[model samples]
Target: MPGLQTQSIHAGRSIDPSTGAVVPPLHTSTTFERDPDGEFSRRYAYIRAATPNRDSLEACITALEGGDETISFGSGMAASFGVFQALAPKDHVLLHRDVYYGVRELMEGFFAKWGLNHTLVDMRDIDEVRRASRPETKLFWVETPTNPLIEVVDIRAVAEAARAACALLVCENTFATPVLQRPFELGADIVVHSLTKYLGGHSDAMGGSVTLKNKPELVAQIRDFQHTGGAILSPFDCWLILRGVETLVPRVRLHCENARLIAEFLSTHKGVSKVRYPGLVNDPGHAVAKTQMKDFGGMLSFEIRGGRAEAFAFTAALKTIARATSLGGTHSLIEHRASIEGKTTRAPESLLRLSVGLEDANDLIHDLDQALGSII
Candidate 1:
């Protein structure tokens, strides 16, 4: 097999047969012509069902994740919705207590209304996972190095529980992209990603994917949902994500490097009450993360000394790192996750989530030092 870097550049890419272009041509046509015998010989009937660009993007993700098949969607939430839609009404899903706020909204706000059931549990506790299982449980949704809190879950342990319950295990790999962690290798049945993050690397595109590990029946079901539901990723966005995949390896390496330095810096600061990063030897998730992940990943969060007011002040004082919502881009971003998550937020009132970017490590530390100084 080709190395990750090599695969990133060459996988799903080919020279244009007719134009002789080195890069794959972006196919924008919504509909394809049929054969004279009323056959769609080219195999693509319409954009929603399939498209050249989307197929190429899906191929790249499938290869990178080492999955049997991958299904692309317009956004991360759409991909998640596709998975839930695959389950029958009244089926139960076990969600990480600190999973992305949007996912909670999807289950509690929308899916609940449709008779779908869900329960939130601390995935770090294998016993908690086993205790939460019900006869109707159909899925176990996990997010390692969880959103905002940066809490890591042991995938292998959780997969065991899922197996005993006869439930499908779905791992959200958005934070720890394929570069740092391979969930399928760790026993995940399905892997999902928000291409809007690390895979896009540049934040210019919005997309998501669900990759199945040898589950042919599930693949067909989700593919049918993707086609009939019409929430497929756009061709242009697919091309953009493919372009990002070419440099994912190097970009993620730098993200990990810079994040480690920043986490260490924050740990010793008096104004920071806690630093949540698996790279830290003292972190609660350190041992488990080190066993499963190649590196600790780029996202981290810390609690300010005071309350929400202090957290807001610190972020406002930063000159270089922007106060932003999303992560995995060229620019570093910081957000008070509590405020963003609203009333039901589990994030500490003093917590700030930082999305380390491809920037000078010293400069980022200095920027943080000055901001903490201002707040202190």
Candidate 2:
């Protein structure tokens, strides 16, 4: 009610009714209590219909994005699928070439089976985006500061094009959390997230969400699908993610601070070829990022001197950072983009994506230096 920052901890939740606990309790019941007299019914009657924890989490995200409604799913991919289904079978989807790999896999597999046509375009170039559009282009999917490579796209420009074409613009707002950016404010129709990441800052839970900007009917449609499809997030995971959202602002501040240091270190290192981070003054997307995002996010990517072998070694040798995938957590992670991409030319062979954590800036820098020492 006060602001996004305050609501992150208190928006959809109040004191516990039964136990008077500060934090909300996880409701594990398959069904909720109904009015015995049948005079009135509670807000939700079943887990699929609704849950207090799920509603609370949704309210927090909706308030953060200034959205009208929010929906939860088993994972980020489920949320994406809901959007995919919301579109007609023949509708076209245009996405940034460098978005989440899972999305590419879905586009090539599941969505293709449904007769949906899509394209991967360099959205930073408005002309390229304009040229990629057909009269059938019904959805423009964007992942700014994109996965692995960290390519920044123009949200407002793409939104404008979608508006003119009477299409919907959906943005994966995982990297730039609501603390850093709000895509709906820039004209996004739907804002999606992998709550398993930043929103659940600890690496303990897996979930996803979608907040709607203006489509109440679409919200009902997705709710019906989610109810029938039953890819709903569990009570425990939703509660964990809700608790995780509480520290989002402070955690993001540290993540950006640590990442800025790592980006600076990597930029000047002899072993690194190119550093990709919006925080860098000379980064290709710095100006646009500065205009859109409140601050440069914690994720950055850089190319090592050699190819795959050297990149793997660099990641494996990191003492402080973990070698894994999926970003925006409390522990720093270093991943070889080539291995995860399954041999896609989209990611450079020598590239390493860094997910900076809330560690001491100096310790992270030293760990990176020592790791690079093995290959430089």
Candidate 3:
């Protein structure tokens, strides 16, 4: 097998046979020509069903995640929806207590009306996971280094509990991209990602994917939902994601490095009440993260010493890091997660989630230090 960096650059890419172009040509045509015998010999019938660019993106993601097959979607939530749609109505799901807010809304607000049920549990505690498993539990959704809180879950341990319950373990790998953590290797049945964030490193594209370990039946169901639901990722976005995959390895390495430095600095800062990062030896999730991950990821969060007022004041004072909603780009972004999550928010009022970017580590720390000084 090629090294990860090599795979990132070469996997799912080939010299264009027709144009001999080094870069894959963008196939924008919505429909393909049929053979003289009235057969769609090219294997693509419609844009929604299949496309050259989308196929290429899925292929690359499958290789990166070491999964048997991958299905692409218009957005990360759509990919997650596709998984739930595979289950029958009245089926139960176990969700991490601190999963991305959108996922929680999708289940509790939207899917609940369709007879789909869910239980929110702290996935870091295996006992909680085991206790929450119902007889009808069909899926266990886990997001490690969980959104906002940066709480890590032991994927292997959760996988065991899911297995005992005969449920599929679906891991959200958006935070720890395959460059750092391969969930399939850690016993995940399915791995999903929001390409809008890290995989589309520029934040220029929006897409998502579901990669299955070896479940052909589930793959067929997801593909059916993708085609019938009409929420497939566009060819242009697929091409952009493919372009991002080429640089994933190096970009993620730098993200990890910068986050480590920033987390270390925040831990000792007087203005920070607590720092949530698995890279810290004292972090509750540090040991588990070290066992399963290549390195702690770029995302971290910290509670300000005072309150929400201080957190907002600190964010307003940052000159370099942008006060933004999304993450995983060339520029650093910080958000008061509680505000974004609204009334049901589990994030602390004083907490700020930071998405470390590909920037000078010292400069980012310096920016943070000055901001703290201003707020304190």
Candidate 4:
């Protein structure tokens, strides 16, 4: 197998046979021409069913994730919904307590109406996972280094429990990315990613994907949903995501480096109450993260000394970081997770999530220092 950096650049990419172009051309045509015998000459029939760009993106992602099959969706939420759509009615799902709020809303709203069941558990506890398993439990959905809180789940342990319960284990590998973690090697059946984040790198393209290992039936269902359900990403978006995948290696390495520096600085700062980053030896998830992940990711969260007021004040004073909702962009973003999540949010009032970017570590530290100083 090629090194990850080499795969990132060369996987699913080939010299254009027709135009002799090195870069894959964006296939903007929604419909393809048929042969004289009334047979389709190419693998693609319609943009809704398939496209060259979407195929290229899916192939690249499958290679990166080390999965046998892959599917692309219009957005991260759409990709998540595709998993539920693949399951039968009344099938149960196990979710991490601090999963991205959108997944929670999906289950509580639409999935509930459709008779889908869910149990939210602390994924760090394998015992809790075992206790929560029901005969009908068809899926174990885990988000390690969970959104906002940065709590890392032991993927191998959770996979063991999921396997024992005869359930499909799916790891949302968005935060860790394939560069940091490969869930399949840890025994997960599926890997999900919000390509809008780190995979797209620029945060300009919006897309989602599922990479499957040893699950042909589930792959078919997801492919059906993608084909007939009408949430397929556009060719232009697919092309953009492929372009972003080219530089994923160096980008994530720097992201991890900068975040480590930022987290270390925040941990000892007087204005900070606590820092949640797996890179820190003292972090609750540090040991497990070290076991499963090649590098601690670029995201971390910390609690301000005061409550929501201080959290908001700190973000308001930042000169370099932007107050934003999304992550994995080139620019750093800070969000008060509790405010965004509202009443059901488990995040502390003082907690702030930071999406560390490809910025100078010292400059980011200085900006954070000034912001915290203003709050004091």
- Looking at model 4, which ten-residue stretch has the lowest summed lDDT? 36-45
Q: Report the lDDT tens digits of candidate 2 across residue range 23-99.
A: 89888888866688753266878788788888898988888888999999999999888788877788899999998
User: Residue-wise lDDT of candidate 4 within 9-106, one digit each (tens)?
Assistant: 77888889999999999999989888888888777778899998898899889999999989999999999999988888899999999999999999
lDDT of 2: 0.89
- In the range 84-199, model 3's lDDT, one tens digit per residue, is 98998889999999999999999988899999999999988899999999999999999987898999999999999999999999999999999889898899999999999999
Candidate 3, residue 304: lDDT:
95
Q: By descending TM-score, how would the candidates be arranged?
A: 4, 3, 1, 2
* TM-score of every model versus the real structure: 0.98, 0.97, 0.99, 0.99
Task: Name the weakest run of 10 consecutive residues (lDDT summed) in model 3.
Answer: 3-12
Q: Report residue 185 deviation for candidate 3 (angstroms).
A: 1.3
Please report how far candidate 3 places residue 7 from its true position, in Å: 1.2
lDDT of each: 0.93, 0.89, 0.94, 0.93
What is the C-alpha RMSD, rounded to one decimal, of candidate 1?
0.9
Q: Model 1, 363: alpha-carbon shift in Å?
A: 0.9
Candidate 1, residue 40: lDDT? 94
In model 2, what lDDT does residue 295 have?
91
